[model samples]
Target chain A: MTQVIISPAKANSMYWLGRYTERVYLELHLLRICFDFMIDGKPEEYNRYLASIGNTFLYPDLAAIRSGLVHDKNNPVSVLACVEMANDNAILLRDEIMSPTLGYIQMSLEYLRHAAAESKEPDLDELQKLTDWMLAFWGSIEERVYDERVKNFLRLGKLIEHLDMNIRFSYKFYRIEEAFTSLLKCYDFEPRAFSGDALEDLKKLITEQEYDPRDPVYVNKVLLLLGKVVIL
Target chain B: MQSLIKNRDSVNRWMERYGVRFGVYKNGVFNEQLFPFDSIPRIIEKEDWKVLEKGLIQRVKALNAFLWDIYHDKHIIADGVVPEEFVYASKGYMPECEKVDPTGKVYSHISGIDLVEGKDGRWFILEDNLRIPSGASYPMIAREITRKVSPITFVENHVADNRDYATILKEMMDDMNGGRGINVILTPGRYNSAFFEHSYLAEKTGAVLAFPGDMTVEDDIVWYTGLFNEKIRVGAIYRRISDEYLDPLAFESSSLLGVPNLFQAYKKGTVAVINGFGNGVADDKGIYYFVPKMIRYYLDEEPILHNAPTYLPYFKEDYDYILENISRLVIKDVSEAGGYGVVFGRDLSLEKLSELKELIIHQPRRWIAQEVIDFKDLEILESNEKVERKADLRAFVVSSGKDVKVWKSGLTRFSRNPDSFVVNSSQGGGFKDTWIMD
Candidate 1:
């Protein structure tokens, strides 16, 4: 357990790893919620779910968006893109995170690639598989990562992104509080100077703000502050 | 052999799942394609390996001594065993590396010596890749999966276990730990051609797989910085990057991939740079012609291995021979590598041959011509059938802690194109494992 010096480049990469894993993990959650819509002949239902995740263009319709998420290599928010990025960062952290721990991420990416090559539609079954892998990745992060500081950094990213997604989709009040609490726990392990004021502000907002899904200005500000809260 | 061939596809599938691919960049686009594995292995008999092991060890010892000598005293050059001008004129020779000695005076800790078996069944040394040699990990990882795919093959054959490459590499790095800090494999980035080997070796050796940006020099020592701001001192860097890009200040000032003042840390003996900074002089194409002389000069021994029938245009007699037999020889530019800058005379048109002759005559020291050896071809699986392909072996020799050891396995690269003799992975060549019979 050599002391981990999070170089600027690696910190930046891990920050993105956190965001991308959460993006894949949670986006698939959104897709799973919308999957039944597409399959039950209620594509508009799927379109509304897509809108909630900030997808502006619903044109070219259900099949395209459904397949695009899992199949498109260029899709910035695609599951394939997110999983690939997560695995790439994991490669950088090969010493910090073992390969058997990264096995889940690798399998998930390989599955997505195979489905794309086979021209399989993005369906509930594939979504479930991705969900399982993402969960396993988080589990591995907790159980397998050697150094506590390394785990803390990854968890910091994961928690920040979890908070960002929670705010973006306006999850239930209890879910927001739970994610916020988890982020606080992970950020405490970091031995650097971070904003206690910012954390306190965000905590106050979470506890006191009126529940409104449409008024995301305050939520966006909190997200910005969350990005800044981790100092490095 | 039959069962191994039958299960080749499954082995390859496992390889794919394990990301056993090489990266190539062309026209500014990077593509990672699998380094296809052929089922038919190139087997080396124990008796043959006995001779090869001795030769490889002797050759590398000579090469390492040559590197150390070239950097410190000029005994070999001053004695006129090798011309001083020829030694200094090589682009691989670094003037900044003068008088710097690594731990145990081992410059090439790991050496990839390329050899070919002639039709007469005698092996001829083709190349010495002292500067940042690769491909050991290819066979190491491939054999792991192949063994799993067909365990019966190993149970029957008296093959030496190849899985000890990682252990050997770790011991080498650990023994060469000059600063007693962490050992790291410094790669330029994932986009480099051999990134897979870099990452895989790091994983196998438990060394930190560090990018150029992930490390920095402080107080004349190298340090590995992790994602949580924890910094560990790095004693030995098994650098996969090229020499020119090693340190921006000492070599290519424009190379951001290199750490600033890292060469100074190495110079101060605060770090051990495996396959030391100025090894190119020993493995230089022009200098390769002088290896036998080096063996005689340094070790007072006769050369056990034979270099190919080679002609250096820099010499008067060799130049006359090259000029006379321009159509029957293979000319290689000393500066070019990875199957590039190699031209067989028969493959050249009459006009091209004449142009090459002019280039050789004017820049005589730039090229070396060799008589083409009709090397024995090995049959490989091609579309479920056996096809004979030209292949060469790259045997890894590691000098660790005052001793040199050659691995029992090697990477056997073969040409994918039927008419071509180029067998570099960068040139779309495929590879198979080399089994040393126990």
Candidate 2:
């Protein structure tokens, strides 16, 4: 066997792949609603819905979200950009994921590249095919690779991205719980002590009964929930 | 079939999918690019391989003996086969490793020797890369993909299967470990030149790919630092970094890339460092002059392979010869590898030749001048056109449990430019899948 150089760059790569792929998945889920509103309901109503989510600056108009996700590589939140990020991270972490999975990523990138080059509004079927391939790529990864620490780190990246995008509120709470719980069970983290009052506030968010999703306290509640679950 | 042969785009795509790449740094920025593969392959006959295998094993064994002698008794130096100045002055000579025996052996556990066949059809030694030689995993994997893509081509030919490289590696790691815990592969990072290869072999051999930060030294043993729980003991580390960069405490005090106290840990017999320190002593370009002598002294047998006719500029007579025939020689700096610091006398103008002669005279010990051999070229398909380029084979020899096994296939790198004889892949070169008939 040949001598291999396992560097920090590769680890960051694995960590980033976990984050960007999940970002793509989360955005695709959001696009379903964005697309539905554009076709069936009014674009004005969808814009209002996006504004309520916060970071409306990312996709301010429903029509913009519908047309811009696949077209713009400049948009940090765009699907095209997310896939590009995934490809970059995948190459960096290529040693951990093995070659077969990497082969799938290369194929998926080519598919997206061709789709973006030819289509204005990419056919939903073609978009779904690329999405499905990306998901399948992740699925095969779970089956074949078995380093729990590496897996949990990847999940930590995904969860953090979800929290950043303000999409964690819509995510199944149990999924976040499972990810946090697994991080706790698998690795013994040595974190620096928190000196601030966020701890008490986080405690109140979890213990208090009025932490409801229907109120204007949506962001506060989600933050408290995410914080309580993660700060082991 | 014709379409397959002419498909440059498909081959490039396949290279990306298979991850055949080497990293290069341009203007202080690192970039990874595909190591272009030519559809054409270099074939070796069964009879020829038999001779080549014997020669490689013989060469590697003598190198191993030389490394042992360097660290232990200095008998070779005492016997005056290799000059004391050559042993002590060479940058590869490590004084810190004196009297420290690793697993009761001192030579390299892994060696990648570069060789080329001259126009006369005789194999000549190009260089010996005993320090962390790469590109074995490349041929091991590329051959598999190549065979899969062109099954009929494989069926028609008698190419030796290159899949056992990982198994051979496993055996080597295990032999060094003495049945210890898991074998871990230490990589510099994915940005390193052979990062793709590092990852592929780690996966294939079931060795955990670990970075410097991933490891910790405790109780004199090396363990993988876990994020959550128990740290697993790493018995053997097939490190890819050079010895000077492996342990900051032992070598370069300012190097952040190395694991701290790694040398002390290895000295304690807690971990094994494959391709041991001081292996580089035998690979120095000046050391090439004495390898034939070392073989004769150590093994009492004649060398099977021949070194290119070389002149040691350190010798007055040889310096005179080089100065007289300066335009016909290939000059190399003893300290540099990877196609760097090599200058062809024929390519230089008269003024440049005069300047080189002065430099050689000023620092004679720093250089070696060899008679240029016109090696055979291989046909490579680049942009739908066939071109011939100078190529050389880097053969990997792995030693485990008192046995040395030579992998059948080698990395056959070729220069992309027609007039260029240099074939280091980092210098805008490409590689061909080498086929060794058994």
For this target, which candidate reaches the highest lDDT against the unseen true structure? 1
Q: Against the hidden reference, what TM-scores do the models get?
A: 0.94, 0.87
Q: Model 1, B304-353: lDDT tens per residue? A: 89999899998899999999999999999999999999999998999999
Residue A108 displacement in candidate 1 (angstroms)? 3.0
Give lDDT tens digits, candidate 2, residues A41-86. 6857666555544333465554456656665677665678788888
Clashing pairs in 1: A4-B230, A5-B226, A5-B229, A5-B230, A5-B231, A6-B226, A6-B227, A6-B228, A6-B229, A6-B230
> For model 1, how does the per-residue alpha-carbon lDDT over A1-232 read when each residue is reduced to its tens digit?
3333657666666666777888889988887777767778785676667766666543386778778867776776677878888878866665566665656777788888888899798778647888887888888777866677667777778888888878777788888888778777775666463577787777777773654555768767777877777766
Off by over 4 Å in 2: A1-16, A32-68, A71-74, A84-96, A109-125, A146-217, A220-232, B1-11, B104-106
Q: Give DockQ for candidates 1 onward, in order.
A: 0.45, 0.31
lDDT of each: 0.84, 0.76
Residue A175 error, candidate 2, Å: 9.7
